[model samples]
Target chain A: GAGVSQSPSNKVTEKGKDVELRCDPISGHTALYWYRQSLGQGLEFLIYFQGNSAPDKSGLPSDRFSAERTGGSVSTLTIQRTQQEDSAVYLCASSFAGGNSPLHFGNGTRLTVT
Target chain B: LAKTTQPISMDSYEGQEVNITCSHNNIATNDYITWYQQFPSQGPRFIIQGYKTKVTNEVASLFIPADRKSSTLSLPRVSLSDTAVYYCLVGDEPISSGSARQLTFGSGTQLTVLP
Candidate 1:
């Protein structure tokens, strides 16, 4: 792909339902990141993948949230028992390492929990 | 973490030069200043970056002070297309504290370029 790609550009789910978002990073990129943006707010760090494994998940807001990357290229973010507060845009980005490299972002998935 | 402060918004006319300044009073010696531009409903795009002094590219110029506590992103002869939210980010490797090159975004300055 030409850039980072995210699935389900938009998602609306009922409270308590589980939802999953997917991201496919730019080919050969070694770093991937996930962030959340609430209404009129700045991007909040969620989780990131150094390759196929996440070195840090401290940004995950709660135990209801989890993520995984496979084959060092694709990632999935899963949220369980969704609550209204879970509504926000989920953005995925990729970079090349200490990579001082600029991040390439996906259009993002706007998840709306009802 | 190195924190940055920037104007909330700015208005400019097409064809004029636009300068957005950011203040990071406690910036680290290894920190690098970076700028990103985002249009409505889209992901932000990297504009330019600098570690010190001045750095120029085909799109913009980054000017950092000797103290490295502040930096400015200069867009020459702006156009309406330049209207967007401009973010100032300061960091080194591991873009954020979480451990990757995660560029943290501040409450960017909204630049409105009028034609």
Candidate 2:
């Protein structure tokens, strides 16, 4: 793809339900990231994947939140037993292998848990 | 990771020049400064990045001092479409870093361009 692509631009789910957000990064990019933004809040880093290394999961708020990147291209963020506080926009970004490369971001998935 | 601080909000008129400054008092040697702009309901878009001195692109210019304690993003002529939240980020090896290493975003500065 030309840029980072996310699926299901908007999602409305009930509390305790599970929701999945998908991201497809640009071809040949080796780094991907996930972030969450609540209403009128700053973006909170969730996870990061670089090439074939283990993903950085320190930013995941709780055990209910998990993510996986397959084939070093597409990634999915899964939120289990969603709560009202989980309502936010989930953003995905990708960049080249080096640290100096700028990140390309997707429009993101807006998840609303009622 | 280097923590950044920016204003909560700023106001500017159309066609005027706007400058937003970010402070990173404890930036490390390997850290690089980057800026991003985001509109309501949209993900952040990369604006510019610089390590020191000045860097200019078609969109904006980034200025970093010798001390590296702070940086500035300058927009030549602002327009209503330029109204957005601008974020400043600092980190080392954004790629190739192991787990627990990544760029962190602050609240960012909200720039409003008025008529």
Candidate 3:
């Protein structure tokens, strides 16, 4: 089976710009999640989607950060008005269901804000 | 949610058994202890999970005592490639659809497997 995949392995953008990171989960996976990892820091949760249920956005740092999983297969994490602090690796993961299966992660997109 | 405490760093020579302990005094009944291994420039990979007692997998083993307040990740005959950061997380079923399964990752224990 193919593993989860993310696009734009690396991205460099100036401050105040917006960027979109995409993720394609493994087939048949209904639960998708987005996470952020800053240098020398732990993984920070961003948002999550599970089938038709309401998406979980509690972990999202701010209003500027938003994510959407369309058709329950692919997801997009968008950062509005990026800042230097936003420099980090954006990771995506998928699972069979919420709380039932372990998560499978993608290699992630490294975002560098200058 | 429970707060995990672990060593900031540890070093071991190749072919040696490495054990890293994590403390979570406030662990709840629904919370399950999970461990993840992460390398530089990569997302974390799941290692093992356990509720109580002990759980062993092909890659590693997890030992949880009767108290369940703490757990240990034991790696057998660690190699240089095993050098990475290990995170211990405790999470439960979300209360609502809007609740993220977002793991509360601690300042992980960095294991340096030296040859």
Candidate 4:
């Protein structure tokens, strides 16, 4: 794909339900990252994957939040037993395998837990 | 990760120039300074990235000092549509053995271009 793509642009779920957000990175990109932004807040780093291996997962908020990237192209973030405070925009970005490469971001999925 | 600090908000009028500054006192030698602009319901878009003194692109210009402790993003001829949150990010390098690009974002500066 030309740009990063995220699925379910908007999601509304009950407090205890589970939600999954998908992200498809650009073609040939080897680095994928997930970030969360609360209402009127800065972007919070969630996880980072280089190829199919996640080198960093320290930023995941809690045990309920987990993510996996398959084939080094697509990634999924799952939140189990979501809470009301989990309502936010989940942004996905992908970059080439270097430090100088700028990350291209997707439009993000807005999750609302009622 | 190098911590960054920027202004909370800024106000500018149309046709005026806006300059937002970011301070990163603990920036590493290999760290690169990058700026991103985000609108109300969209993802952040890259504005400029600079590693040294200065870099200018079509959209914005980034000015870094000799010490590399602080940088400024210059937006020329601002308009109402230029109102957005600007994030200054440092540390695009690999900190550990197999770390990918790690970007630490602070509360960005909100620039409002008034008509």
Candidate 5:
């Protein structure tokens, strides 16, 4: 719609449960990004999509973390076997393809691993 | 991507002009300086961006010098609602880093506008 949108504004999961967070980027935007922010901390890059392809996946914190984007519009970030340390606000952002294009961010999904 | 350095925190009173500066000593020729502001419980909002000289928008102004090593974000007539964390980011391509390095906005300056 008008801006980047994220699903389940808040999510609480058990330690071993899996969770998926979805993002709908601004229409026609070719770049999407995922970032995590712990309480009182700066943002940590997770992964990004140039269209539906993620050029790199090494930024993921662990093997259990994965992300995918489809239709160059919607993207999902999945966390497996959640840990207490995984609790943080997961943010999604989108911008035009260029590097200098400013990103439009969504209100993040605050994931709490209990 | 160019690494950015900024202060940890700053304080200003209402109606005062506030300038937060960011230093990027190794900024590349293609790098552009961008600024973002975030409040508690919300995502960051773009403030302004610049390559050199000055850029002004309804919300703020970005001033970059000739050398491009440093840039400043100037907020005019601050108010309590302007209290937030401001980040300075310098980068070329968002996804071009591949697996080598990740784009980052370093610990930002926490600006508190006292009423």
Candidate 6:
């Protein structure tokens, strides 16, 4: 099966504007994750979703950042009133969430807030 | 989750075997070490994983000492294409309770393969 897929390989928006990043996890994968990678930095955990279980939002940086996984498959990450600091590569990953399966990641959407 | 520390960067010449070590001094008994590789503009790709002793795949080899506090990723005969950032992560594999956790990556080590 194909790996995780994320749309809008690149996105540019004004600092005060809002933006949405989408992720389509691998078919049949029960767990999904979103991470942020700033230039020359490590991957920062953002949010995670596991089946019908409540999504974990503890990693989200601020109220302006939110995410939702619809139908337990596709997910959308929205950033409101974006700040320049929000500029980074947003990566989406998915796995079986059991037996210590490794995560498969998408190419990611590079968000640049001007 | 255990914290991992790796060298900020390393330089090697093409065709040389490179070994990058990661330190997780506080690793737990249940923790398993995994390594990932990332090229520019691409998401990370899993390389190798191991609990103790040695584990090898077509891509790389993982060596963990009995102490379990550290692990090393060894690239065999690296090439220019092997230049990338390598990350090491230590996580409690999976408990019998069917619980799972997110993987935490450190500021990976950047490997430059020079010709």
For model 4, the superposed segments whose C-alpha errors exceed 4 Å read B95-97, B100-102
How many residue pairs clash in model 4? 0
Model 3, TM vs. native: 0.94
lDDT of 5 at A7: 93
Candidate 1: tens digits of C-alpha lDDT, residues B1-115: 6778999999999999999999999887677888989887777789999999999999999999899999999999999999999999888767445464335678889999998
Q: Chain A in model 2: its TM-score?
A: 0.95
Predicted chain A of candidate 4: TM-score = 0.97
Evaluation by DockQ, superior candidate among 1 and 3: 3
lDDT of 4: 0.92
- Give a tens-digit lDDT track for model 6, residues B40-67: 9999998888889999999888989989
* Candidates sorted on DockQ, descending: 2, 5, 4, 3, 1, 6
Q: Mind giving the per-residue lDDT tens digits that candidate 3 earns over B8-84? A: 99999999999999999998777789999999988788899989999999999999999999999999999999999
lDDT, candidates in the order shown: 0.88, 0.91, 0.87, 0.92, 0.90, 0.88
Specify the poorest-scoring 10-residue window by lDDT in model 5 chain A: A50-59
Give i-RMS (Å) per prediction. Answer: 2.5, 1.6, 2.2, 2.2, 2.1, 2.7
| Runs off by more than 4 Å, candidate 2 | B99-102
Top lDDT model: 4
- Give the better candidate number (1 or 6) by DockQ: 1
Clashing pairs in 3: none
Clashing pairs in 1: B95-B101
TM-score of each: 0.95, 0.96, 0.94, 0.97, 0.96, 0.94
Q: Score the docking of each candidate (DockQ).
A: 0.58, 0.72, 0.60, 0.63, 0.64, 0.54
Candidate 6 lDDT, A1-114, residue by residue in tens: 688899999999999999999999999988888999999899998877887453466788999999988898999999999999999999998888666678789999999999
* Model 5 docking category: medium
Give one digit per residue, the lDDT tens place, for model 1 in A1-114: 599999989999999999999999999898898989887777787887888778778789999999999999999999999999999999999988774788888989999998
